[model samples]
Target: MQPTTPLFLQKFSSNAPESKELQRLTSFENVENKNRDTYLDMIRIFINRNHVYRRGHVEFIYSALKNMESFGVQKDLEVYKALIDVLPKGKFIPTNVFQAEFMHYPKQQQCVIDLLEQMEDNGVMPDYEMEDLLSNIFGNRGFPLRKYWRMMYWMPKFKNSSPWPVPSPLPDNIYELAKYAIQRISSVDVQSQITVYQTKEIESSIDDTWIVSAQAPSQKDLLKNHDLKEPVYVEGSFRIWVKDQLVNYFVLKRQPKQHIKTIKDDLDDVSNIRTPIFSFQKPIEKQVQVMQSVHEQEDGVILAVCATGTSTKDSLLSWIRHLEKDGNPVLSDALVVFTLRTGTREVATVNNVEQKQIESK
Candidate 1:
C-alpha cells in the first residue's frame, strides 16, 4: 500500500450534479414582463415539476426570493406567502428537543428563514395564514416562526405612520408624480395652492413638459413686495422621491434678509390701557404690524416650488413666465437668475436663462 493516506486528503463523495430547480430558475432570466402572473406561473411550473418529493425546494425558494424584485413582487405579501407554502407541511418539524435546538433539517429551515428575512427587508408583513404555514412546515420551535412574530408586532406600528402620505403604487406618469411631490412639499403651508401649467402655453418654450407649481397667497404678496432690482433665483436640480421615482424640482427663491432676531413680549406693557371712570380699565386696540410670514425664514424665502417634466433651463424659464402671468405681474420687471448645474457637476449661472429670455423676446 502507498504511504498512509492523510485523513484530510481521504476521498469524499463528490458533490451531486447541478440542481435542476436552480437551472430552471436561471432560465427565467429570459422573461421580460416581470409581472405577478408570470412570477406565480413559474412557481406553479416548479411545483408541478417536483410533484413527488419536492426535493431541492430549499434552493428553489432561495432562487425565488432573489427573483421577487425582478418580478416586481418583492413588496407583495401574497407572493411571499406562496413562497413559504412551497415547503411540504410536517416534514422539516423536529420530533425531539435536541433536533429542534440543533435546527432540524438545517438546510431547509435556514432557507425558509432567509425567505422570511427577505419579506422583512421588503416591508412585507406576514398574515395569519403565513403563521400557520410556518407552523406546519417547521413547527412551533422554528426560528422563522419567531421572525414572523417579531415582524407582525413591529410592522403595523410603522405602517401608515407618515403624515405626508403619498399614494401607494405611485403613479407612473411623471406629471402625476410631480403633483404628489408638490402636494408633499406644500404640507408646510395649509393654504398652498398647486397649479399645473404646460410649457407649450408659454409661446417661447422649447422643452415640452408639464410644470406643477405651489405658491401660497402670502408668497404671492412677498413676490410683489420683492425688490425689482434684486434678481430672484431659480434654484435646484434638488431631488425628492415620489415613492421609488426620483423627481427633480426647482424653487423660486431669494436670499434671506439679514435682520436682528427680536423676541419682544408685550405682556408687561400696560401703556395702551385707558382707565374707564365708571367701571373698569379698557384697553385701546392698537394697530398691529404685519408680521413676516412662514415663508420668510432664516434660510432663503421660498416664493414658489415646482416640478417640471423636463428639469432643463428652458422649462424653468417657462415656469418664470407662467408665474408672471398668474397674478404676480411684478415678475415682468424682476430679473430672474438661474443656478442650474450641469451633469459634469459644474454650477451654471444666469447666462443661459438670460439668453433664453432674450431669444424669446
Candidate 2:
C-alpha cells in the first residue's frame, strides 16, 4: 500500500502503521521481551494503528494467533477474547438468512473460527462476555458462534470429569511433572505413596540423577512373595503427556498372575419363583463373590512405577537399588531384568575409575 515515491523514503520510514506487511514485521520485532504483558501490548498496538478502517485485522489476528505459544499465553482466556475483540463491531453480522447460511466474508469468518479452535485445543473456556462480543461481531447464526455454542455446551461438562485433577499449565520442572505422572498411574491403589530417591546415594551409580517412584504396600508384599527364581522386569520409557510436555516413565513389573475368569450368572434374572414347568432347567448356583483389585488384570502386574531424571539403564539400576534400600529388601536377592524400548541395557557404572557393565544376553 506504499504510495509512488523514491524507494529511499519507503525504506526509511517504511510507513509500518500504514501497511499490514510492514506493520506485522515491525510488531514482531518489537515483541522481543516475549511474555504475557508484551504480547497484550502488541495486540493493543495493532488495534490502535488500524482503528479507522481496520484494513488488515484478519491477517494481524492470524499472525497474533500463530505467536501465542511463544509468548506463553495460548491457554489464557483473556488473550483469546482480546484477539476476538480486534474485529470491528456491527459490521460482519449477516442480514439475510442467505447471508447467514453461506459464508459471508469467508476469509474473516474462517480466521475467527481458527482462533476459537486454538482456544478449544488449549482448553480455554469461553465466558458469557465473549458470547456477547461474538453476537455483536457475527450475530447469533455465525459459524464461529455455532462453534462457541458447542464449546459452551460440552466443555464445562468435561472440564471436571476426570477423577485425577492436574494443575492447569503443567510445571516445567521435570521432577514435579514426574510426580504428577506417577500419581496418576498409581491411582489404582488409594494407599500408593510417592517417594523421591537420589541416584547419588548409590556409591557406584553413574548417572547421578533423581528418581520419583510410586509403590503401594500391597505391591511391596507382592514383591516380597515373588520367587527369586523368576526374574521380574524393570520396564519402559512409556510416555504420557502433561499438557504439551511429554514425560517418559518406567515400571517394575512381573509375569501376569495365572487365574481363570469365571462367568457369572445374571443376578437380575428372577425366575427362582417358577414351579415344576422349568424343573428340567439347571438350578442357579450361588457361591462366594470375591472382589479382586483391578491390579490383577490380564497384563503383567505393575509392582512399581518411577520416572527417572535420566532415563538410562544405570539410572534404572539405581531405582531398583533405592527400592531395596526402602522397605522392599527382597529386591536385593530377587533377579530384576531390564526390559526397555528406548535403548540397550548394556551400561557401565563408575565408583571412581573401575566400571562395570551388564552385557546383553
Candidate 3:
C-alpha cells in the first residue's frame, strides 16, 4: 500500500535529504525488493546529482556493486559506462576501491581500457590538472609503467601532454664547470673543508694579493693591498670574490669564538644536528652565485680568504697535499704557497709548484 512514486525518487527530489538517500536505499532491508533496473535508475540519479566522484561516492559505488551481486543483479555495459561517465574530471579515483572493483572483473577492466582508447582517438588527452592527480595516485602506489602504458604511448599525439616539463641540459663550458664546483662544495659535509677550483679563463689574471696566515690579520695588514688613490677599501674592508664572482668582504675583527660557541651550544641539544642545520641553510643559492660569477671575473681565481687559525691552515695544506698525491693535472702544475707572518717578518714556503699545460676549455 506504499506510494508508487518510490522512496528513492522522492528523497532525490527533495531539496536536501537528512542522510545519503542512495546509501539508505542500498541498505539490506530496503534493497531486498529493488530489482536491477531500480538499482541502475538509483545509480543514474546519484550520478546526475553529484557529478564529482569523491572518496565517499567511490565507496558508495563499491558498496552498490557488492549489493547488486547479493541481489543477483547483472551489471550491463551501460551501467559501467554510466559509472565512468560520472567520474569527476581531473580527479583521482580512490586506488584501493578502484582496483578492488575493476581489477578482478575482466569485462570491467576491458571497459576501462576501451574508454581510455576512445578518449585518445577523440583527441581528449588528460589535461595538466588530471595528469597531476594521476601522477599522485600512480606514484604513491608505485604503479608499473606498463600498467598505464596506453596513456603514455598515446601522449605524443597531443601537444602540451607532458605534465612535468624537463629543462634542457646545460652546455659544457666554464659556466657549467663553475656550477659544478659550487655544487660539489655545497654538498660536502659541514665538518669537511670546501675546496673550489678556478676556471682557466679567470686563472690567468688572478690577483697575487692573497696570503695565508696562521692567525687573524690586523686592520693595517688587511688594507695593505688596497690602492690608496682609488680607495678600494671601504672602512678598511674590501669585497673579494669567494665562490666565483659572488663578492663578500671580510671585516678585520677578532676570531668569532663567541659566535661559534653559541652555535655549538644550540646544536648540542639537537638529536640530529646534521639534517636540521644543513637543510635550514639552503646551499643551492651559494652554488647559483658561484655559477653567476664566471662571467664577471677578469683576474686570476678569486679566493675570498677568511682569517682563521691552525685548523684552516691544516685543512688547506691537507687539500694541497691530496691534489699533489693524486697527481691532479690542473692543480699539480700551479704553485701553492703559504706565507706565515711573525711580527713584521714574513716566512714563505712553496707548497707545490709543478708546471703542466692546463687543458683547453
lDDT of each: 0.77, 0.80, 0.37
Distance from true location, Cα of 347 in model 3, Å: 99
Candidate 1 displacement at residue 248 in angstroms = 1.6
Residue 347 error, candidate 1, Å: 12
TM-score for each prediction? Answer: 0.75, 0.78, 0.24
Predictions ranked by lDDT, top down? 2, 1, 3
* Candidate 2 runs further than 4 Å off: 1-21, 24-31, 50-52, 260-293, 346-361
Using lDDT as the measure, the top candidate is 2
Candidate 1: worst-modelled 10 consecutive residues by lDDT:
8-17
Error of 2 at 313 (Å): 2.5
Question: What is the model-wide C-alpha lDDT for candidate 2?
Answer: 0.80
Tens-digit lDDT string for candidate 1 (331-355): 8777676767653222222223435
Backbone Cα, N, C clashes tallied per candidate: 0, 0, 5
Better of 1 and 2 by lDDT: 2
The residue ranges of model 3 lying beyond 4 angstroms of the native Cα positions read: 1-10, 14-22, 50-55, 73-75, 93-361
* Model 2 Cα shift for residue 113 (angstroms): 1.4
Cα error, residue 14 of model 3, in Å, equals 8.2
Residue 71 of model 3: what lDDT?
Answer: 50
lDDT of 3 by residue, 101-148 (tens): 444334433444454454454334444443344344333332321334
